[model samples]
Target chain A: MARKIDPDQREQHKAAIAEAVWRLVARSGLEAVSLREVAGEAGVSVGRVQHYFGTKDALLLYGLRLAQQRMEGRIRRRIAGLVAPGAEDVLRATLAELLGDDPDTRQAVRVWTAFLGRALDDRAIAEALFADDVELRAFTTEVVGSPLDAHGLWALANGLAAEVACGQTTAADARAVVDHHLDRLLGSPDR
Target chain B: MARKIDPDQREQHKAAIAEAVWRLVARSGLEAVSLREVAGEAGVSVGRVQHYFGTKDALLLYGLRLAQQRMEGRIRRRIAGLVAPGAEDVLRATLAELLGDDPDTRQAVRVWTAFLGRALDDRAIAEALFADDVELRAFTTEVVGSPLDAHGLWALANGLAAEVACGQTTAADARAVVDHHLDRLLGSPDR
Candidate 1:
């Protein structure tokens, strides 16, 4: 006999588990992720983690996808608040997310760099993480609507994020870098 | 009885050990690195590895520093072969290394990201990595000699390198993106 969970409850548990994954990854990279560890971090039983995500790979993939979605949603919500934002404004705001100023952003960037490290050795991870690259690149391209290289723009922001995450540079410097790139790409004389 | 090793032989042994570290890191990320593992990978005994590197942290730090030196040397050699290379030419050659087209470069980039992942969790790693960053950024700034952000340029290249290393993008595409940015940066109307 098993207890049935509502859809909302299931989603909550899943999100909680994913949040645990984030914390673990931020602290110790992707290699630290395991069912038991995630369960411990989430304050749930290993049985519950197993019931939701069958294997470490599945759990990791789920966490990666969920984080990606959350990041996208956050950027979109922020953009929505920009009153009558132009293409450059939107692009700048989007790239500005790479500054990793906030705690969430810093954790996300750490997880991302960890994933990139894993991707080098694991084809499955490479596939799972890069699958969305095309759509993400297309989004940047559409947002820019200019001759600038969208992929390059995304990479630049990512690099800055990595810099901030590794404590190599400050968020202010990262933001300045993004704004400077935008100034050149959008042909704006002023920031 | 202790045998005195020549300077060149000692340097060679250390380099061999460092190369082993790169291979393991490239294959499985930084979390996979350990003293015994590196010794096995280098075809040496554990005692020998300990004799050379002292501890896992020291081994990793040494490997990282050695990798940095090799990359700088490689880039410098390439620039040296250029016929009447200008500052922009040198910069292009430097950024081009991030395309990760070659095996060594790919392995290096993987190790770099692995270290970045570890840096998030370990302050010691973060300090070692960020310490060199100032010198690297200064070199780029001197090379650029412009209002354009040198740090941003390096980050852009780093991002593209991560893309190629993760199998998200091709070397040719990454090269094009880098070149496009270079064109804009140097105000070169022609490719």
Candidate 2:
């Protein structure tokens, strides 16, 4: 049975639930995310979760969207911070920022990877993510003056992110890979 | 109630259960795996799963171990099939084969990603995976003419795999990335 909660309280409750979900995903992986488990972790009633999400699938979708929005916002802010930057420099900075090992960036990457696991199964999320990927690639290409196709650039970027997240690459090395790829694409050996 | 099956029948049942589990994981990610669901998919009794695995966790662990072994076996076989090969060529061929879009390799990667998600929460699995990562990096470092440190080479290999899995880079593109990284590490002005 569900309870009739107040509107403001409900919004707060939803946010709380979402935060709990994020922590769970960050601490573990996507499989650790469960409606019942999340409710227990949040100190909220299962009925409240059901009231807000209706189903596990709905909750997952909401969480995924929220995560993506937060990432997009951060990237936009980073891009905005680069003052009068050449396209290549901006791209390099943005890529470095994304793959950095700072705590905040690490959390962001964790959330991103968790979402990636889901995106593999959910076509809606995959479509949205693929579009964003294309946008990111186009932006990078413009910045680097690269004639390579969006797919190539996106692959390189995404691959680098995965490697960094998996603890295989240091932040410095990831940045270096980006620099080299961009240099090759831009036809500038000096970059 | 657990079934009183013979040893041969039990072995067959375990294989069937593992196969069903693989299909579910590949189709929907690891979050969707459940013993009940596996039993249903395998057309077996729930008691049988309990009898064979003792617990859902056990089943998952066993299935993941099988997936890892299969991945190693495939990599070995692919390398064995090559004609005369240099260190650089062998490294590239082995990596390309692992990241290729072949069905077996794809399934192995999918299962690996799923297991990786769960491993974040499971300390035993996490330790084992880290140990495996160390060994893999050490082995890879010896190849490629020592063009990169263990960590750098491992990261490149991981990034390459992730890129291939996401359809972001072609086999040829992955090879190029490897070549570029090797060239940089080798301090070559021209490839």
In order, what lDDT does every prediction score?
Answer: 0.79, 0.67
Give the Å error, residue B174, model 1: 1.3
In CAPRI terms, model 1 is classed as: medium
Best by lDDT: 1
Interface RMSD of each: 2.0, 4.2
| Model 2 TM-score, 2 decimals | 0.75
| Residue pairs whose backbone atoms clash in candidate 2 | none
Q: Cα deviation in Å at residue A124, candidate 2? A: 2.3
Q: State each model's TM-score restricted to chain B.
A: 0.88, 0.78
Q: Give the Å shift of residue B187 in candidate 1.
A: 2.5
TM-score of each model, paired residue for residue:
0.89, 0.75
- Candidate 1 versus truth, CA RMSD in Å, comes to 2.9
Q: How is the predicted docking of candidate 2 categorized under the CAPRI scheme?
A: acceptable
